[model samples]
Target: MILERQNFMNINQISAELEKEFTNKSIEQEDIEKLQALARLYQLYQAGANEIGTKLENLDAEFQVNYDHNPIHHMEERMKSVQSLLNKLVKKGYALSVENVRAHIFDIAGIRVVTNYIDDVYLIEKMLLNQSDVTLMQRKDYIAQPKTSGYRSLHIVVSVPVFQSTGSKPVNVEIQIRTVGMDMWASLEHKLRYKTDIEAELVDHYGADLHDYATELSGIEIKMQALYQKLNQYKN
Candidate 1:
């Protein structure tokens, strides 16, 4: 899939929109500058995500020719809007500044990698991390140790260098690797979690059901992996 950079609003446009939204709150000029800078930082992050996605695609293509199978099924990329970013900062009690954003938010720019099998997820991850250009900052293996909600994915935080006219700076990008089953569960759970006008009790019930479903899905994935391994052994 081709990766495209998204257009961001300019400082004036962002300032006007924020002023309209926060009618009572005074948005100072300094704050506007900081927001503008934050927007630019997001652009850098977007570039980093695009580069990473491209590398993953290239690796998949190479594997297809040599191994007769592609590890990566698809890739998805997104960047948070200015309003959403501000809301999250406020909720986290963070000051509206570039430093605060860089320090607190590791997922402003995010990429998701969906693979055919559980092994494929780790294969692609190892390939990406082996690259000299990608600097591994952190990693979380949710597939091995799932959350209470049974969320399963390999989360990786890496820094990629973005070359600017002024200089080169490293930007952080969050990469999530998951199997097809895991992706399906996560997608549905996210939708239900964000549904409005739903009763609190109903939301809790749904959460419980989703957790149980996720556990079943994980078990199915393990069985599928074992079956695939057995088939490979027979072929060999």
Candidate 2:
């Protein structure tokens, strides 16, 4: 699958643009400070996400050596852009403050883990969360209870300590674990959902179709998992 990387503005560029935005709107000094603080917080978020990704890769390496199979297929990490963060804050009618950003936005540092099989998703989740240093803040098992749109993935919010110049600070990171099939469906669904110049009716139609497709793919994943288990049993 061809995954497109998200484009984000440089931190300095974002800060400059935000200053202009505040100047145009005549926002207060406190609000400006809030925006600046949020930008700086993102640096810490990026570091935390990178730390988690590295840990996962190390776990995969151990599994490959001991079990001869790696559960994780590929991992993708992203830090939320300044414009995206601002848009979310405005949409929720929340003030642009560092405190509000930490309170409301759980996915500022997002990571996606694509696995080879359905069971591998859960296995990796269990193993990762069982680590001594990793703290699992929240978990949403969409595979067991799928969304209305038929989206299926295990979402986990974890707080990992990031040793910064100041000191050790626990930073929150959102991890999304899914099978390859689920990832493929979600990737296409996201593109279709965000396509411009498309009629509203057509978009709705496509969304419904994607939901049905997701359901079918989920069924296939279950059968594949069963077959894999049987094969392992036979091998044993």
Candidate 3:
């Protein structure tokens, strides 16, 4: 789980640092200038992620203080690595330039918000998007329509202003909201399918098993939500 880092980098120093980071990665002298531009572009993305992260944190704090509940369980943020950015762009048949990256890559800055209950997932999304400055660019409700891989979550691409000395730049950030149960299943599935060298036949066999497990987890999540509501009602 990556957290926000200090994104202030001297433009003059970015080239040297980027060179060091991508050492022996088949980078040419001409590409250094382009990479520097990308580094500066990523700074805005980092700031955008931090802004949204702060908003989510503040909302969670407010919920705890005023409503005696915390909708967000935890959050993880990450700025895509340079290699990853390049790979994605190249794989998607986009030119490896800052302009193309900004135009095509929506998940350059990503935040995963995990909540305790399924209802809290939608609640947090509603609260975050209700802000005047946050503009909804795109939304994919995978919870309602699970992916073929049995993946489920609400993915929202939002643009938030990252105020700089010059002006306010609307930077895009991808936010994924999911309940603990959904997260657990997704994490496990990712590990099994991606993190290992499992054979395709085995993966196909376990894919159905994973989907069944996800369904079971979903049932349990609903039950837990019901119990939580009952407990809160009883306390009130």
Pairs that collide in candidate 2 are: none
Alpha-carbon TM-score of each model against the true structure: 0.87, 0.88, 0.89
Which residue pairs in candidate 3 have backbone atoms (N, alpha carbon, C) closer than 3 angstroms, thus clashing? none
Using TM-score as the measure, which candidate wins?
3
Give each prediction's root-mean-square deviation over alpha carbons: 2.6, 2.9, 3.0
Which residue segments of model 2 deviate by more than 4 Å? Answer: 1-11, 26-33, 233-236
List lDDT for all candidates, in order.
0.83, 0.84, 0.86
Q: Summing lDDT over every window of 10 consecutive residues in candidate 3, give the lowest-scoring window.
A: 1-10
Give residue 86's lDDT in candidate 2 (0 to 100). 82
lDDT of 2 by residue, 111-207 (tens): 8999989989988898888888789999999999999888999999999999988999888999999999999998888888885668889988989
Candidate 3 or 2, higher lDDT = 3
How many collisions per candidate? 0, 0, 0
lDDT value, residue 148 of candidate 3: 80
Clashes of 3: 0
Query: What is the Cα-based TM-score of model 3?
Result: 0.89
RMSD in Å for candidate 3, one decimal? Answer: 3.0
